[model samples]
Target: MRSLRLGMTAVLVGVASACSALGGDDTDPAADLAADLAAALSEHSLGDVPLGDEAQRTAFAELVAPLDEVPVVVDVVDVLEVEEEGRAEATLAWRWEVSDAAAWEYETTVALTQGGDGSTWVVAWSPDDLAPGLAEGETVGLRTLTPQRGDITGDGGAVLVTERPVLRYGLDKTKVEGTQVARSARRIARILDVDAAAYAERAEAMGAEAFVEAVVLREDDALDVLPAFRRVPGALAVRDTLPLAPTREFAATLLGRVGPATAEVVEESGGRIVAGDEVGLSGLQARYDEQLRGSPGTAVVARGADDVLRTLFEVPATDGADLVTTLSPDLQQRAEDALATLGAGAPAAALVAIRPSDGAVLATANGEGAAGADLAATGQYAPGSTFKVVSSLALLRSGLAVDDVVSCPATTVVDGRSFKNYDDYPSSALGDIPFVQAIAQSCNTALITNADRLDPSDLSAAAAALGLGVDHDLGFGVYFGQVPPAETETGAAADLIGQGTVLASPFAMATVASSVVEGRTVLPVLLPDHEVQQVAPQVPLTGREAGTLRGLMRAVVTTGSGRFLLDVPGEIGAKTGTAEYGEPGAAGDLPTHAWMIATRGDLAVAVFVETGVSGSQTAGPVLEAFLR
Candidate 1:
């Protein structure tokens, strides 16, 4: 018998020699030992290493079981340092691919003692040989942690959009009997104040056991009512926190909603968002999503099968920051209430209130059921007579005094197209009246007749003076207004009355009104913490121009279209607009876009009603309601 010490490399080199001596390769001991080691490492288990080895198998299994926990990928580097009748060494590399790419490479040395009979070698097995620093009872694991989302607050620290407790009432289709499912869905829908038929249709489409949410009500709102709902068959309730406003209709279009991230949003977020993560879906929430969603955390750990004991690596999650806004809950409620008074199926309407002193947007209320569009802040409609303020400023800059005599007529024609005053044009006001009285009466023909006094750029320049056409750097979507060059006399005549390619949002008109009171361009501010500011116009209103503009607007409220507010308590100044839109009717009367803008103290508001009959008749009452 010759003394033999063999390693994985030596076993391959001696295969032919050993095969000839033994007369067959199948019985070679080195080949058997090499096969055993390779198979054991590959399966992450101990084969027959020690003779009759029950203890060795148990210990090695414990260490390798953790690899499965973390799903470690292993690669054999090489085997070296084999000396006859001595020891051999093997190098192995392992990696947790879920975390990183680098592998942990280490060497395992095993001493081989030749059997006394000299035909075999026995491995001196130990649990530590499987991985460096790995103990007998250790295992690996992973934990994913998410950070808390940012809260959205309004003026005076009113939480406009924050996590609030709500009862999510729904039906689990699979839990209910087939005959009772529709009945149960309707019962739950009735309790939740949702459409019962819609809920039944939704429930029918879901797979068995699917949770079809009927409604989500505030915790306080449902607290007294939840018990009665719980008694309904197949009705299930789960309490969860959702980013919500005080009321369901409170600035819904402006604040938007937060829900599970969509596939498109997830892809756009790079690796920041995973499936099932909640993110802002619209309005300001969608605009400021990255800032609202904080960083996530990851950790790799090792523990016993029964207990968590150690952490190998960790990265802590960073919490999100708060988003403080300029909204006022009280004023927002009032704005919404005022818009609702127009009755159901009212044409699209909006009211926007701004603070002149600091340019903070106090309220933005779109009419109830505005078809999900942010009409209060983003809708594009003709400002109608509301645009007279810009024309007045342009007139004043051309040295026309508020007391300057400007003719007011029932109708005026320019470039073969007739522009007329609103229907039932007051016979008493159809004469040569002062400019201020012309504005008060919302004399459209008067402004149209005077279009030749200034260049087309003059109106745009005047509009820019009132923060209308210039970029304001507002963080959210807004159509300030647009004024193309009035190349033709007809185009200029239309521009004088805020028609023909001129469009403005309620928010933009509110800004225009505020600019007059502030004596400069007053840019609306929503996100105070955000660095963007409403860029000031190149040529803002002068102090004298602002004073004259304010005096003329006062005439509007005192004796013109906004005279409805004369009895109200506040010191109000206003301008009314009735822009003709759409094709002429059978009687050659065009539909009008009614508009009104008024200022009192630090507050300036703009109101609009598409398809309104007149500024005084349609938008005036809403303005009066808000002011009162």
Candidate 2:
């Protein structure tokens, strides 16, 4: 009886200890192994977990049995060759045929290490997605490839940016290579401002076969600083002709933009690269990309590991052709100055200047930020009083006398939409004003009241005649001024006042000024040699109407918003607009858009102050400085 009680006690103690081991919180070698197996078997729907021993496996099976509807299948398998720290790795692999014809395979890495008990445990496993080498009987290989860059130039064919020198660093990372290798690598990182551990680990992962880029530093900057890299025992420097650009934002819009090489270009060249091989994405560079890109010359050589030759490969590279644009430096500078003078009030304006004789675009300026691929020219906005110029021309063409009397009560409302003269000034519109005087003074009541006299279709046609709403191939982006609906006289009236759907680019307004100066329609162009043969009938303003509109425009420069821009000695004509439009219930006060269009001698100009209270005040000074 005593022996029987002792045996029973020993069995009870063994069972309790076994239960405790199964529930322990420390990472069980079995559980880790299970997770690793699952990752390797990801291609298969089911996964496997490691069991430390048959005893543990039995316990796990009993624990999972109640929850599983089907009997769980537990298998113990041994894998070879994978090592954690010089020991075999316990791993699992998956197989799933995507389709009968498609391939299905699993590849992965595993961790193996000997434990304190001298038993090897599978510590970890990588997913098949990140794994390698489970497919049957196939050879896979990879090669490094790089992009061919292109030369970037300025207005005068000045190669501000070019591909000059490329540097490659050779590193020896074998632990047997001595401590000097690691220490030297650390010094290189400190000098280059690169992460040291990252560089070291990359070397450890990729080894002697990898290449490190040293292309960012300029020729002078790199040459003067190369000594810092030379101290590394195994690191060697190689020069390669790579693409370079001098200016960061110098005419970024017109010149187009470039970026790093794409994978396809690298593959197409069979893993070899040509210097000065860049692709154009926008502006003249994009439009004439083919011509500018030019054909590549060939080079032949006995190569090194990289397939690049120390001297000329047999085929020399063909230089790309030069492209000349019509942009004028002096004019662009002047237009920019004009926008800045508009002040903080009008920070969202656009301006375009065009030469009527050749349709050459003198300059274009904007503050619309970026909308799609286009810049400011295509952005939407209210035209304000500047639009009234187009309306006045339409009315004059409709036989309304320039001297006709139009009584204005300082304020008028159309369709519950009320408007004030020039400003909310009561004194400005206290009395009767003449047709021409109304335009010169920019009287809202005078224009809006007379709005009914002009045909809606005629009004629409006139705006269209001025190129108000037309899509153009501007390379960047362009906006066409819009006409308000005519059904509502109120709508027509609003349109007459340069509000309600009317929007334009600084370039468009400049074209309008050019039309008046040349007595013919005009448009903006960026290239001197660009063709401009309009196939449609040219819209013409009657002689009397032209005379009247011209006189009013001239008066605006002499006495109104253009007063500040009178520095030009010759006859100059211009008009200004300050308009506002925003959601009815917005938080901060909405800004006003300021605008100014001027013509002097043969030169025509347009200016926009992004969001200024008054065009006359904001853009006038800028135009004056530029024209003078």
Candidate 3:
């Protein structure tokens, strides 16, 4: 039925005859009509086309309304004159860019008829002229098909983050009266242990048909609140699945979280992401979001008045690629367990373990006290006496041997700043001790007294050799510690004992221990396929120097502060550190950071506590638990 109704009319006209009547050049009427029709469809405008009446122009606008959301381009393919007088068929190339990843294209033909005066032509309108097989009751729409989000895997290809069942609790405004929306929101908020007033206010401000979400909980966790939630007038608990780890705190800080895409994420995506799409929000998940999210499929579908859909064009979705890491599940659990010994309300703490042979990070765990911060890899704190591992190397490079004599007094002063050893320093080992004895006992004054033997850059240079200050891009957030050159005489003396601006993370200190075990500067690796960009130090550590440093660290466990670790099954080398912070005369006692680093066989480990009395008493037990 070619009725040419105003609501769905298609109009095209030939301007060549009109131009000829105005004393213009020669032009084929069919070709001019085809050109005019292509411009009319592409711009969705009928003002320039010669239509029979205003009704036909309005119908042309209605016909293109369904395609307003997408970009459209039309080109005239050809025009053929039919046997019927003053009649022709025009073919058009149609293209619609639906999304950044998909497009729809097809060819359709329309009939052209000459007017009674035979000077202009108009297209016989119908729905098929817009799209082939597009019936009178049908309209076009686009559908996005979400791809499967990839899983995060650990050592031995053990799946870490995968699809798990959960329940979304929310206030369904459509189910209740407008006045009862706030009441239902408050009820659900109370059952979920959230702020009732805030939830009620939010629900009251939303549209009548909105679903104000209260919370999302794992299926097992929702068991207690399910009955109470159902009693609310508008409450709904929708069951769904999400990518999740085995436990809530398993690796929350490092693995990150996933949720609906925020406005910022959508705007930054340029066109790849849209509203309501699930996306990674932070940590490793955010860093590798594109690889894990994959590409979405699109379908250009037509729906009739009966609500039946027919796909006009489609592109299949591509599933995301799995992310492989070097982290070990068993070792990661053990590390978290060791940190649990700190008990509730403990200060921030972290533990990091690495394989010296291959530089693989086996575990990186932050205690509950860290409050979801990746402190193991990004925290920066003064290293204290544990940095003597690097200082020992600098002193050894300055012509001092293990058997060489060095002074270790109860107290020593440099440039009017007085320095003293730990409170429990052994009186028997105080004066004129061997260099090895000073290292094993962590004698601060002994290292400070030899400060003049080293240049301003000596500490920084040696720190680089031990992999403390060298930076590497490991495909995620990381801090490799920092050692700035000392400018003042007192600053130089302080830097030797790791007290003046020397800072390191647990991950960086673990690398230091690993370097000693590997007999070179060892760079840590997390992602299996990421190529690390290594930064070389001015003077790299040698095999002989690492061997000597290992023997000195071993003596600490054999006879010095780390004697508690002697009962552990393997041969261990360790260094303990206690660094003081805060004003000198402010409080009862200045707080100290506890730190410990150790190596056994191919494994190197570091443990740090934000505040403690001593490294041996505080962080040492945690390290021992992890080793066992």
Model number with the top TM-score? 3
Q: What number of clashing residue pairs does each candidate have, in the order they appear?
A: 5, 45, 1
Instruction: Estimate candidate 3's alpha-carbon lDDT, on a 0 to 1 scale.
Output: 0.86
Q: How far off is residue 233 in model 3, in Å?
A: 2.3
Give the per-residue lDDT digits (tens) of candidate 1, residues 1-628. 1124331334322432344222134454543454466556666666666532457777667656645544444454443334454334334454544433333444554443446666665555655456455455666555676778888899988888888888888987767977688888888888778999988988987888798887777877787767878888777888899888888889999988988889998899886687889898998888887787777666656676678567655666677777889999999999999999999989888899999999899999998657778888778888887898999898888888888888988888898999888776678999899888888888888888888889768898889989997765678887888876788999888888888878899999999999999999887888887676556566778988898889989998788777778899889998888887889999987788888899999999999987788877889899999999
Model 2, position 432: C-alpha lDDT score: 88
- Compared with the true structure, all predictions reach lDDT values of 0.78, 0.56, 0.86
Would you list the rank order by TM-score, best first? 3, 1, 2
Q: For residues 373-432, write the lDDT of model 3, one tens digit per residue.
A: 999999998888999999999999999999999999999999899999999988988999
What is the per-residue lDDT of model 2 for residues 1-628, given as tens digits with 9 covering 90 to 100?
2123223311111211223222244333443454555553342222344433435333433332322332112222333332123244333343332222322344343443445664345343222212242121221122112224445443344454456665654464542254655565666676777888776655555644444432355455567657766766666666655444342323445556544435565465553323334565555566665555555443212223454443211233345665545556666556555555544444455556677665676665553233212333555666678777788878877778777988777778877877777654446535787776677777778878777677767776676656566556544455656675567767777777777656776667776777667666656666544454442324654445545667878888776556565667888888888777664336565567777777776777777666566777766667776777
> What TM-score number comes out for model 3?
0.89
How good is model 2 by TM-score?
0.60
Candidates 1 and 2, the one with greater TM-score = 1
For every candidate, C-alpha RMSD to the true structure in Å: 7.2, 18.1, 4.3
Ranking of models by lDDT: 3, 1, 2
lDDT of 1: 0.78
